[model samples]
Target: MFAMLVRLYLTVAGLLLCSMLLVQQAFPYLFPDQYSQSARHEFSGELALLREHLRGVGIGELPERIAALNRSNPDRYSVLSPAMALRLPARVLAELAASGTASDHVSTEHHHVYVRLDHGDVVQISYDESDFPIRYIAYATVFAMVLVGLMIWLQPHWRDLERLRDAAARFGDGDLNARARLPGGSSIRQLCVYFNNMADQIGCLIQSQRDMVNAASHELRTPITRLEFGLANLGDTLDDRVARARVHALRCDVEELDLLVGELLTLGMLERSGPMPALERIDLSAFLRASTGVSAEELRIRSTHIEWELAPALKEVVVEPRSLGRAFSNLMRNALRYADGTIRVGAEAVEHGWQLVVEDDGVGIPPEDRLRVFEPFYRLDRSRDRATGGFGLGLSIVRQVIDRHGGEIHIESSPLGGARFVMRIPWHQPGEWRGRSRAPREEPAADAGHFEHSFHLQ
Candidate 1:
């Protein structure tokens, strides 16, 4: 801080001195009369006051008395024109010649005072430049004060800049969360906010990548271990039936491994940074029924029921159909695992876009676990047992796909006494959508009721 102040002081002082020197060098020729006339006006009052004081002394023997005064004070006082050979400017000579009064005053280029006396001679008073270095000192002092004030104003800016530099340095050194905190009212607050935002996004991205790598490594172990155990058993087994069962178990393990890898790849694609996928305008009702129809049949074998009926007005929605279908499939499969007898699914237009709801009438998630249930490899207590639950990658896939669609998913207590997962997804093209009628969709053939349309709207 001291070094900065010193530098500013020197720089500002140098420029001020140079500028003053330039004005002094050019003033006589460029603005000759302006400065000279003002200077004369200023000292004119002093000259008149002195003349008044000397009025009592009388001017009868002015020339003789001036010579005596000059002899007495060689430096401070001088008598001019009549006796001393002091050179005067032509303008001053003309003014003196034309004046009706005796005490006419004029200013000189060398910065002297001239006063014409009644005795037809002029009195000159020349000031030595050395005696008043205080004037130049006054200018420097004012410049110093101004420079100090400027430094005070700039101190906060410099401090903020230094803080930002340190934050960037720490980030470069692998501190992912390093961020600059500046005062709210500071001049560079907007810049600091943008920097902090960028840092946060970078940190989130890296953390997500880390989570993916760790979870993939951990989850791949079960199937690989099973395959190894199956290989160990294959050569030693004697019974044909036992061998067939072992082969079936091996095939299932291989299929599970393939499914896990496929899901992982899909999740990675969703999380990766890229341009948005091209959208297709599709009938939302037909798409929903077709996608859920397969899931409903699969669940029927396990005696699981899914109640899905798309609203008629929700027909045309712009979206990446394949990816969105995968997300919906995830929700369907997830609901089936926990649903006791019935699963409810539907879509409705909301203020911004569409809200797809999946609810089950089974065990609802605990309040504490609701937030983290969407994370990869996050399994509920029931789900930890493979007999009842999956590998825990299903909801994670749903979340990634939903996030890629620029939407959010939230969980709440269902009206059906189970967990309700609301995937609030916005339309791909916001400009094309407005309010549309919520007419009913074509009814599916009822086989003593497949599933219920569970929306409680009267």
Candidate 2:
């Protein structure tokens, strides 16, 4: 707010200074004769009075009379000798010689007049220049008043803008209920109304999408369960081997469809706008071990070696256990499919949070496709076949889970020559942790290295 005020003040100040300069430059052109006419009108009376005083006064007594006039008047009075009068500008001297009276302005504040007496003395009348500082002080007071008025005008507008900015930020961060509430007389009231309308439309659209996905997933479950049961019964009745194999294939297809529906349901749940899931404080090391072990056992990938690199400093983290566990399981299963012989699942302490990494020793994802891999139904060309690829909702669900935990996940090139999925989650969830007891640590095997512990599958 201070920065914004400073910028506004500087802009206003610059414009005012520029306007003063432009007016100064254009004033003469705009009113060329006004200055001269006003100056003449002003000093005409003074010149007449001086002339009356000097009339019939002898040249020798002119200096005494001028001194008396100077002591009584605010303006200076002087008598110029013929030689001194010769030093005047030719224009002024000529004008005085022709009209017996002349006026000249040295600057905007300094004015001078000359009159020719009958005794050949030039009586000079001029304004004093000592009031220059007073003029500057007046200008400064005016400018200060203008500054105060500007500040008064900007205060309410700045306050309104800040409220709008905060509402927009909260809305962007997924608070669909956030709205900018401003006074009716506020200058930006229309803008606030527009923003609120936009937010409403967007919130309704997202809610609609979630509701549709939920409805579809629920609708699919019944048919999928019936088909699975029918396929199982039909397979049992089949006698021929080829027919049984075909029935098994159909069952597999139905199972895949059911899995897809389940993923869609989970995605919809994660995307719902509401309070977060209940959080539990769990030991990072135990969670990693359990998640990786479960995924390996489920996939039955015994040939691949799993290594754990748990940082000692990382003790416990607050998270929704079920959702985070599912995310880690998905990452492990993904690594299992692409790993050549080894997979690394590791956790380490980092600034503000902890880092979880799952990497394999297979071909790394291309840089261009790393981010897109987290989009639902997105897969690389090489993983297009059913044997290697999933329905492609796994990584999308992983991202949603991380987002729910107020964390971020990204893919990087692994040191082991494959795609590395890194999840960074904060150490604590707001208003969630209640100081639970830490899980008992598992002792490392004697052969485990100092940097990491290993769980050999085969």
Candidate 3:
């Protein structure tokens, strides 16, 4: 809007300046007839009186003497011959040369100039000087007028801009109730109306989100409390083998419920957690070796082959230590549950970062389920309900953690005829992993059918 006002001012100024210059140039050309007429009248009256004066002086040739007077007074009179004044009717010349005068002033084409002879009309001459004053006056007037017009045009617009800026600042500062009011009869009143409507929509959306969080929390808290209380009461009554078995099952159910509730809460919190998890440089070799050792006992029960080919240069990777550890654990759990012949875990330093691969020889994930398997509470096999030892959040958590670390995950059918999960996490700095690779030997596969049946129960 301010730009438009500037354009308007420039356009007006340009047109006004051009108009003024044109008038200054054209004024003299447009008034030739008027100048001629006024010049003729003044010259005729002066020349006639001069001729009469010559007659009184006893000059026989009055016309010739008047011509001589005009020649002698050329500087003081029009360049036309004085005798040309007689070309008017004899009566008009007589009246002009009469002993008495009508008025002392005569109007020229441009202005008024008064003339009078000292005595007996010996000489009479005058010229108007007020016809054209300085051209700066016109220019200055135009400039001032344009300045005033621009101020008038921009005053309301500036106020509107100020109001919009103030409202935006307040809104950004979280003042949802703040509003920008337009002038009652302003040109941009509609814009202000739309802005207010948009603010209203945003406010509604925020309120709805808060309400959803509150309702979900309330619904989930009740079941979690009941499960915790039931588990506590069961522990008090357990003594015999039968009671102990029932209590153990109850404990397992309670643990599952607690994990589910914790995951849900984590999802909610992570969505609003503005900052990424804290990052630090980590030695990938040491980290992976430690993770493998911690889960070695569990993996031994599967009797599945496991191999590692960690790159010598895949040492330190920049990641949030806790989140990265959790992600790795989730991946390991998934692989251990489904892998049959062998699971290969390795890292290779690539151009951008350290690339980690976890491949196995179990039934590969179907093409249709690859993407859906990453959604919360989503499972590939509909017949295998999540209640049967699956919560469907492992891959979802993997994706969340990878995203927070600015990494990417890739899925493909591995050469080993099983699903493969690849992760690319950036190195903290270049050339930081100049060391040796560490890996463990492979083991045999577990009894295939035995593993399949016992896996879900575990």
**Each model's number of backbone clashes?**
0, 0, 0
Best by lDDT: 2
Best candidate, TM-score: 2
Off by over 4 Å in 2: 22-32, 40-49, 67-75, 80-102, 115-122, 128-131, 293-302, 429-458
TM-score of each: 0.49, 0.84, 0.47
Model 2's TM-score against the true structure: 0.84
Ranking by TM-score: 2, 1, 3
> What is candidate 1's lDDT per residue for 1-458, written digit by digit as tens?
66877787788788878887777666655765566466567777767765664554545655556566568666545566454533565665665666511222232224665666654556666655545789779887889787878699779988998999888876754457789999888899899999999999988988788677657856786767777676657735746877767776766666677666766777766655444467678888788767652454667676877777566677788877788898888877777777888899877766556778888998898877877888877788643544565667778878766665656677777878888887656656633222222223223233312223342210
Q: Write the per-residue lDDT of candidate 3 for residues 277-311, one digit (tens) a residue.
A: 45667888788766642365766777886788787
Query: Which clashing pairs does model 1 show?
Result: none
- Model 1's TM-score against the true structure: 0.49
Q: lDDT of all predictions, in order shown?
A: 0.67, 0.77, 0.61
Worst 10 residues of 1 by lDDT: 100-109
lDDT of 2: 0.77
